[model samples]
Target: MSNWKKVLSLGLVLLVVAVLAACGGNDEEANSEENNEQTEQESNTDVNEEEISIGQINWAENIAVTNMWKVILEEKGYNVKLSVLDMGTMMKALESGDLDVSLEVWLPVQDANYLEEYQDTVNFSDATWFDNAKVGLVVPEYVEEVDSIEDLNEHKDLFNGEIVGFDPGAGTMEVTEDLIEEYNLEFELLPSSEPAMLTQIGEAVANEEPIVAPLWTPHWIFSEYDLKFLEDPENIYGGVEKIHHATRTDFADEYPNVSEYFKNWKMDDEQIGELINYVENADEPIEGAREWVEENQDLIDEWVQE
Candidate 1:
């Protein structure tokens, strides 16, 4: 009786120990699976959290390129927001880290003041998109009387004693102010929006009247109208500038992929000109950008390649 009881008790104890060990193994496996699922979910959350805010000026080129990048980035599964800001506000936003990126910053000449002030706070792209940019007074070809900024005072009456200018704080307007002071021209610069300035210029040109306005290259106006940049003998208006993108100083660290895309971004006059023209004529700027992006998949692929 004692032997049988001992043997039975030993077998029962061994069976219980084996069953408990199996249960513990299953628990460990379940916990491991749960931890793996959580890690995968967190990684996906990080990907979904990748959002970028781009600051864009209302200038023609800036609008075109900013919209184009927005389309491209969104297509690549990024959340992109675009804000139309003035030159001063854009720079300040970049400095304060409110904006992630800006696609237009004319360097070595136009926008020099903003760049100088925000250099420490912002980071510029390694390469420029457009290298041949200019800012100056422009007129229709029919304005035969005024061929140069030096000739403006002689024909100031033609422009109604005021020069058509873009935004008040724009880089071009700032340089135009200096031009007026340096040339001692008897003309006033009327601070107007780009569309307003363009409307006035369009009317003046339509009537074969003379009109002078602050203008920039790579703009759609040059393609739409037979216009020419007035000569600046004094060279107050910066001759040629390279357009570069800028971002917050920490942008690259946070968004390495986007930073790489911007570094690889480059466009010549023709490409940018076509983009501006397309955007200017489209029903909406983003529509035009999407069209351009659709047609340029190969180029976009190169830019977004990791």
Candidate 2:
């Protein structure tokens, strides 16, 4: 009785110890797997946190180019956000680093004041996207009588005693106000948005009525309408300017690749006009930009190449 009972009890104790050891090993393996999964998830979050914000103005060319870059950056695995802002707000955002980049900045004249104010805080691209850009009072070709700013005063009534203008804070509108004072024109400068000004132009042109409004080149409107820029004898609206992109001062150091892309970015009249046309006609602006990006893969690749 003593020998057999002692042997059985010893065997049972050994078996129980072996089973507990096996269970501890499994627990360790499960914990290791769980930790590895957590690390992988954290790594993916790091990758996805690579985000960029682009500021866009409501202007036609600005809208076109901003969305185009948004699509391109998103394709390159960036979490891109597009923020539509007004001129003053955009400039301030860039200065404060609230916005990462802004694609459309008319320089040497159109937005000279903004550059002068924010140059210290914002970094402008080395290369311009478009050149020979003009801004002035535009009239349909049918308003042949009003060929120059000097002639605008005489025909103020034709434009309904108002010069249909773009947004109030826009550089174009500022210049238009100065033009009125310089020319001693009686017409009031109406402050409206780009789309509203375009609608006014469209309606007046369709009816063959005279309508003078603030306008700029590289815009789709010129392509769609028979229009002429009213000659500025005083040259208040400076000669051809350029369109440039700007970013927060620290943006380049943080995102050198994106900064390089902005530096290399450029577009000619035909190219920008085509983009604007696509954006303007499409049901959704971003979709239009996506279509353009899809069609211009080679061009984008060239831009993004290291």
Best-performing candidate as measured by TM-score: 1
The 10-residue segment with the lowest total lDDT in model 2:
41-50
lDDT of 2 by residue, 165-192 (tens): 8788887788788888988999899897
Candidate 1 stretches greater than 4 Å from native: 1-46
Quote the RMSD, in angstroms, for model 2: 4.8
* TM-score for each candidate, following the candidate numbering: 0.87, 0.83
Q: How many backbone clashes does candidate 1 have?
A: 0
Across residues 105-205, which tens digit of lDDT does each residue of candidate 1 receive?
A: 88777788887788888887758877888888888998788888888888777778888888878877888888899999999899979989999989988
Residue pairs whose backbone atoms clash in candidate 2: none
lDDT of 2 at 15: 100
lDDT of 1 at 182: 97
Give the Cα error of residue 164 in candidate 2, in Å. 0.4
- Candidate 2 vs. true structure, TM-score: 0.83
